[model samples]
Target: MGDVVRAPWDAYFVTGFDTCSEVLRGRNWLAPDFAWQERQDDPERWGAVATQEMTKTLSRLNAPEHTCQRRSLGNLFDRSTIQRLTPVIEEHSARLLDDLAEKLRWGEADFVSTVSEQLPISTIGSWLGVPAADHPHILEITHNQVYAQELLPTKSELATSAEATGHLRAYFTEMVRQRRAKPGNDILTGWIHHWDAREPDRETADEILYRLTMFVTIASLETTATLLSAMVGLLLGEPGRWAWLRENPGHIDAAVDEVLRYDPPIQINTRVAAEDTVLAGVPIAKDSMVHVLYGAANHDPRRTENPDAFDIERRGTHLTFGGGVHYCLGAALARLEARTLLIQLLERFPTLRVTTPPVYASRLVFRRVTSMGVSI
Candidate 1:
């Protein structure tokens, strides 16, 4: 595929690395938010509960609103915050790996369940001060809710995602109420305080607080979990890679980057033209939807040599975390978690081996490893 091509679905696809970068970083492009949704000819398509819930998220908001809402969480995943959370990541990784080790000793253990899915929620839950008991439910609902964000969701998936969204709203709404009644030192409490100071009405502040909590949890959980699973799968997918990583611990950072490039968690983002513009010499009309294929861009041979090969020692950039203002807020935290987990897992289980090929969810947008059995 070239830089830009029009698909039969009435959307422009940008696959080249440079063109994808331009589309992502360009101010003329906008996320298809609530305002954009309303402009569509099909209201029913945009009227799904999942779509409604997503419109309320920070990621779906345009500038001014996006800027103001984003400002609420100042330096959330900054270097200092990541440094502070590194120990938390390590603790969760070690605990999960310990359980995984025991399971592996007996027989094959599903890394996706035993560690990959568990570690992210544990780390983020600890940071948000959510009760440890609630993590499993939260994780389940999060997985359900993400179906709506997929490249194309079926009617059943949308219904399931709607149900999950409802559960998330109820859970977080209650958590917000309890936090207001009784304050704590956790990030959630801090957000309540921060919002209360800005918004005069308590109920409005509480609502914002509730969404923020839900967003933080939903945003941080699944993708990072996928990253963890993907990294481990890539390392163990081939012989000697894990052992090589164990020996060359200094390449952990490079290994993480290569995993992100080779198989990004989120592959595609749809951006609308804020104004009539030309991309890759093709005229795109205003309000037209453009699918920016980050996964394809990452592998564009023009930018990356031998794009199909997974070389940990290669140094390069990728659109995995996205670009511009909407760049992933949890990038640093995700990286820290991956690095910490890799370090601890390698040190703890040198004989760990993949027992079977990884099983992946049949989805386009989010690359999820549903199951991967491993044994010591």
Candidate 2:
């Protein structure tokens, strides 16, 4: 068990599994609080506008609105929907792996660009009904927007992020308009129909649709890419681990779960105290910022034996997907992508090895592997 530690910024860090769970599940804790907003260097700048657009996402919305939006978009990612996506995931993974194998013949290749980054973006793009040719453009826009979260983004970087945000909003707005006129078998169309059936007001529905599109696109692209990069780097870090996975292909699911718990992409989630409350014997004033360290909670010894060990067979659940109402909506889709890709990779290159040390991005909130050189 861990004690609540106070930071110089007056924020509380909850690390223990039970304490973090209490904070995450407590109704008194609300997201999109002042903590995240405080990270903005200048609220008057263009970056602030881009940040505002992102804060309108499902992850940042409060109850009632959050509840309704989540319910509306829930069906699209239900178990059956994710299961149906297996073929699509496998197809993309196989195609990417083939390209990777061909490139590896030249000695080495950056797996992050060749496979890790492209797979998730392409898979999510297809689900969103984006034209295959536009997937790269969408990827570039989202990637730029994510840099706004860097600890200290330069003025130029923030301006670039703002420009990208503008482009994304416009593109999705037009796409939503088209999808409404001609519904498709894609998730975006499903979302529009769901919003129309419930929202009744066209303008409000459009706003909701735009924000939902941004939320899903960026979340799916960045998090899944980070996960794939980290998983590959970790598995290949120990040569024996790759061989073990290749031999036990059926363990892919467990392996993915272990990776999520071991080194989650999103390391910390923040919430504000909605009301004065006491957590784990600590008194928290109303509106206090509470930082739930998901990575620390996942590694809590009280929650799992040998918490630091990456054992696929380890039992119990992890806080990586979060818990309670705010649990990750795309959890199933992320797992499906990781599992399918890992299985296919092992089958194609059981002897794959990391040719150089993996490079982790210098960000406190997201565990992103910026580069991982590999060869077979």
Candidate 3:
């Protein structure tokens, strides 16, 4: 726990920023009402606006169901599996740099929409057997779909997102059909064959298609992009820090972690307590809302030395990537993507510097610097 933690809202069950060991308690730590998401409460109404295909599978899953789903999917992102994806990571990153070079040369570029957004889309598209030309469209659709829950309005946005969902489902359905006829080495191809072999009737090939693609694409895209923005954003503003990277490139990973700690890509996680429990000395009934504050906890001076300073040499755990059962499955992939992107940025623009203050996304949940003018 840090000195400046975002304590539980109840205020009576507990207080102060405490170590995760204290606040989280156990692997089964569920504050009151953690499972009660706002969207799920009005499924019928939101389904009219959200992707009908995803509501039951993703947004409505409770802890037990989520645990089971995560377990099966977790194996796909295991340390070994993720390590094997490095070549894919390297290839996508190199291509991203090449694309950026062509798109903007000796001119102003919006780093977020143009560059940061390309990474996970390319990687995920490649993994899913999606055609390269279709990645940008997929990213646009997925970006809206991911945020539809928190910030969305009017029927027009809903119609556009719904259309994307249909396109995606149709695309993956065709891809699965192709993989079934002629299986390949790709994950999409493998999963199709594997699921049919194991569960047969229960786990049909296309049953998990759309949601899985959403899980793969959007999860990797947003977090990785935000991390890249935060990491590069900080360095671009401080010439001395950029110079340090030019001198010692190996320190990039530490700086990436420091970025997550200093200004995390993700600021908070929404939780609903599974049952009645106490948090920070506050008592609560079942299903209370819980938020693990990443920003405040990362700045807690008790847990970190000079928590305010963005020092690459500093070492401590950060909750930018949630905790326990809800830990981001894509953490390793996001790290790899950010690291590779940083390397490419260094090689392409060693003297890169920010020409103006970065313009960030308005969303509070996801800390993304949407635009940063850079000069090479």
The lDDT leader among the candidates is 1
lDDT tens string, model 3, 1-376?
Answer: 3222344443222212364434443533552222344425655435554544554453335567566556556466777777778888888778777766765676766777667787777777777777889877777666665544343335765666567676666766666777777877887766665566656574353676445655666667777887887777887766588777868987888878888888877665545555687654556456554555677777777778788787887767677776666566778778888888888898887777766677776665666666776656
TM-score of each: 0.98, 0.92, 0.83
Give one digit per residue, the lDDT tens place, for model 1 in 26-83.
9999988988898888665678998788888887888987888889998798878888
Candidate 1 stretches greater than 4 Å from native? none
Give stretches of model 2 more than 4 Å off.
33-47, 148-160
lDDT of 2 by residue, 267-302 (tens): 888888877888888889877777888889998988
Which candidate ranks first by TM-score, i.e. highest?
1
Ranking by lDDT: 1, 2, 3
Cα-based lDDT for every prediction:
0.89, 0.82, 0.65
TM-score of candidate 1 versus the correct structure, residues matched by position: 0.98
So what's the TM-score on candidate 3? 0.83
Q: What is the C-alpha RMSD of each candidate to the true structure, in Å?
A: 1.1, 2.7, 4.1
